[model samples]
Target: MASGADPKFEAELRRGVVQLVALDYLETPRYGYDLVRLLGAAGFPVEEGTLYPILRRFEKQGILSSRWDTEGARPRKYYELSAEGRAQKNAMLGAWAQVRDATDEALKRSMEAGQVGSPDGAEEETTS
Candidate 1:
């Protein structure tokens, strides 16, 4: 019932994967802006306002650690994954893989049954 640009669907999808992607990038120390650039380059496209809060939450949860870097003209907080963060990332990745496989299987079945879009983008019906 929703269109392609449905805000609710977009929010739900992003919320589900943001943490996993963030953790993946935090494997290396990076500042907030750097994360925005890197993640955007990787097709994530997270805004600074969205990312900083997530970083803070991860830090509070002991999944990330941060240090102040003053080497540049301005100071920045660099974040890296903690030991626990690495373990959590691995677990999340495994769970994501399972979810992806299950969803793909369900979609394939739906398409085969003509309950959804066909390979040519046409709606199909099953005859009894």
Candidate 2:
């Protein structure tokens, strides 16, 4: 983002990517704080509030599971992908790859043709 990037668009973009990024990071068990720090460092900043709800939703949906790890100073709930989660992750990643490739091709065609406003890569017709 440069000096004048649209915040609304940026927020929407981040929202779209959050699930994929969160799932990717949950490849290993991580506590709430750990996940927040890691995601922030990885450029997907998330609040504990935001993260907890998603974690709960994913748990209910059976894509993730959590357990208390009491080995530390305090008991921390750690979350990791379930068997179903792993499969979903792989499927999501694959679908993402297809989307990225398709978007790249569209952009390439746009750049080559130097047109805008539609997928047909044509300039709009003028009205009388």
Residue lDDT tens for model 2, 46-98: 78888888889989999999999899899999999999999998998898899
Model 1 RMSD in angstroms:
4.4
lDDT of 1: 0.87
**TM-score computed on alpha carbons, candidate 1:** 0.83
Worst 10 residues of 2 by lDDT: 116-125
- What are the TM-scores, per candidate, against the unseen true structure? 0.83, 0.82
lDDT per model vs. reference: 0.87, 0.84
Question: Model 2 misses residue 54 by how many Å?
Answer: 1.3
Question: Model 2 compared with the native: what TM-score?
Answer: 0.82
Candidate 1: segments with Cα more than 4 A from true spot: 1-5, 115-128
